[model samples]
Target chain A: MDAIRIDNLTKYYGTARKGIRGIEQVSLTVAQGEFCGFIGPNGAGKSTTIRTLLGLIRPTEGSAQVLGLDIGKDREEILARTGYLPSEAMFYPGMRVRDVLKLSADLRKKDCRREAATLCERLQLDVSRKVEELSFGNRKKAAIICALQHEPELLILDEPTSGLDPLMQRAFFEILRERNKAGVTIFLSSHVLSEVQRNCTRAAVIREGRIVACDSVEALSRTSAKRVVIHGRVDLGLLSGVRDLEETQESCSFLYSGGMKELLAVLAEGEVHDLSVSEPDLEEIFLHFYSRKQ
Target chain B: MTLIKHELRQGRISLVVWTGAIAVLLVICLLVFPEMKGEMKAISHLFGAMGSFAAAFGMDRLNFGTLTGFYAIECGNVIGLGGAFFASLIGISALAKEERDGTAEFLLTHPVSRAHVVTEKLAAVMLQVIVMNLIVLVVSLLSICAIGETVPWKELLLMHSACFLLQIELAAVCFGMSAFLRRGGFGIALGLTTVLYFLNLIANMSEKVKFFKYITPFGYCEGVDVIMNGGLDIRSIATGMLFAVLGIVAAYKMYCGKDIR
Candidate 1:
């Protein structure tokens, strides 16, 4: 069974005429034990989709199910089996990290003390310090520990690495990888393409409140259009199958989908001052998708 | 249950401060009762001459000579206003604080329903108000005993009970308001409490606005009314309870469907 299934889910804030689109008819599914990445720029409905699936915000239309349970009807039950880390982690002031974790464990009715302590130690978080006293990165570490301690079946994280240092981000992702290996399905939402590319097996790209593409990471990369930048004088009509072409006095660049050997031959004909050919990152590919309409 | 415990811990300082202030004020009011006892007749005559001012505060109906009467007039105002403010502060911030402090995402994402969140928070607020009232009751009893005054247990219980109801009613109203507020509602809660108290005052001061008494929770639990009638007004209490229930129900309805941004 799919871990999450959203059917034509849409959310609009305020009235229809003047309303802001949260997400429009967004549909996707994540199979059990799969690590899925949700990629989008800010205000692109990534968090909205996750919040809707968690039953934090009711859909304006359509519905969703998590762990095969209806999001609206079985929210508490689904939440019991799911863990979430919000984009901006916040905790009640004056509480120690241990106290926050204990409250979460108590609410889940689970004995997560050992796991909590272990996660804290692994993240190098001081559990004795008050929440207000902790720095941003430490607070995020505390939030991570809280979300993972209960051993939830599904983990939904939104921008989980924004405030972390490089070392902590590596540690955090390693922990997630370990959890994923243990059969915990993860849905990680991030604006950073490289992070998603490194961790997720499958990814969905959302733009302007719509999912423009969803595919396996390998398939996405294989089908990705290459970005070619050329310097020195070049004939404008030499290339075919090039999209998003742009030219300047000294250099030119375009997204190339044509054969590489033909493009290299064309480049060799010119006095190449400099040349660079690289597989486009998700961000560039995302821009390609977005610019396709124009 | 954990949510309740968390709320209680979070609100501990406010609870202590409010209860302490009320208790100290009540003790002071009770301590001065002995000195005023000898001049009660003169004081009563002076208040009688004040007419409208006396009526506005319900002092016209209550006897100032007896200990219970003196206690009702002096200490009742302190507890009434202080307790209402405390309850309002708690209720107004109950749900709103989670959003204002950006902690709703943490708390609401747990394995609890929105209804569960509302109920647990309301329970915590009720517990705080109850604890505050209990402290006031105990302190009042101690002060009465220290002053060598015979305990008018029935009247004392009646007055305190009425005050408790008034506090709870105000709390429910403010708690309901909290659901709709994204930022803190301290100003609104305080203003509402003050307005309601004045509404009761207007009702007492003039016959034209007597109908306002039915609308204000304070009208049902004014100390002078409780002291003179020797018990709570059953109809007024029922109306106050109905208002409290409606406010709580509205809170649940709005909060359950609310979109936490």
Candidate 2:
């Protein structure tokens, strides 16, 4: 069974005449036990898609299902099995971290104290501190514990690592990997391309409210253009499939996705000193996707 | 149950402060009633001479010389206005604060349904109202006894019951308003409470706008009206409760459909 299935889901912010499109004709599915990364720049509908699936906002068009339950009809049922970590970590100001965790467990009607304690210990979160008193990163840790404690079948996280330190981010992803290995399906939404590229097996790239590409991480990287740098000044604009060209007095660099002979011919026209070609990072690929009309 | 517990815990401080402040003020007034008893008749005439001011607060209808009259006019306003403020504060903040604090994103994503959230929060607000009224009632009863005054059981209970109903009406209305508010509704709630109060006063002061009595809960719970008529106003009570019901129904409908951004 699929953990999430969205079908042409759309959301608009206001009335028809003066509405802002949140997401349009977005369709995707994540099979159970798969770790899927949803990559998008800010306001590219990454959070919108996640929030819609969680039934926090009504879709303007189409429908979705989580764990085979209809998003509108079985929201509470879906929520029972799905854990969501919102981009922002906020709780009742006076509540202790432990209290927040306990409340989440209590709402789910599950005994999560053992898992909660374990997660807190692993995250090095001080549960005794008031939510208001905790540092931003510590607050994120508390949110992480709350999301994971119930052993949910599906975990949906949006920008979950924004406030975490490098060490905690590693620990958090390690915990997620363990969860995925234990048969939990995870959907992580983030703009941090390197993080997604490292941890996710498959990724979907969203730009301007639509999924532009969905493929295995390696396949996505392979489809991206190669970065070529020439030591001598060169005008590479005439070369097909060259994008994001930057020229300095000493050298010029551009993303190349053309015949190697064509790139070599263009480089030969200039008085060459040195040249190097390397694989483009996911950041460049995403930038390429965003710059396109589709 | 979990949500209810959370709501009550969050509101406990406000509950204590409001209940404590109103109850202390009532106790202090009741304690002074005995010392002022000898001068009551003279003061009553002085208040009667104040014309419209006396009528606005129902001092025109009850003899201040009597303990029931004194308690009705003095302690009644204390509970009426103070309880209204307390209830309105809770009701206004009950749902809106979740969004204001940016916790709605954290909360609404859980297994609990919106209906569960609304009902549980309403239950918490109702519990606070009942608890505050009960505490003040106990204190008022004890003070009356300590003063060696006749308890005026029927009058006391009627006034207290009326005040409780008034609070419920205010709470329900403000709770409905809370559904639409994302941030602070303090000014609105404050203005609403004060406006309703002055409406009652206006209704009392003028025969021309007597219909204002139907629009405000204070109209139904007037201490002098209870003292003189020996019962709560049935028409006013019906009207007040209808508003309460409308407010509660509106709250549920709006909140369930609202987008939690």
**How big an interface RMSD has model 2?**
0.6
Looking at candidate 2 chain A, the ten consecutive residues that score lowest on lDDT are A285-294
> Best DockQ goes to which candidate?
2
lDDT of each: 0.90, 0.92
Q: Candidates' TM-scores?
A: 0.95, 0.97
After the best TM-score superposition of candidate 2, give how far the Cα of residue B251 lies from its true spot, in angstroms. 1.3
Which runs in model 1 stand beyond 4 Å of their true positions? A16-18, A235-250, A257-278
Fraction of true inter-chain Cα contacts (below 8 Å) kept per model?
A: 0.85, 0.92
* lDDT by residue (tens digit), candidate 1, A230-278: 8887774866768778889899888887788878788777777998887
| Per-residue lDDT over B106-186 for candidate 1, one digit per residue giving the tens place of the 0 to 100 score | 888888989999999999999999999998999999999999999999989998999999999999989999999999999
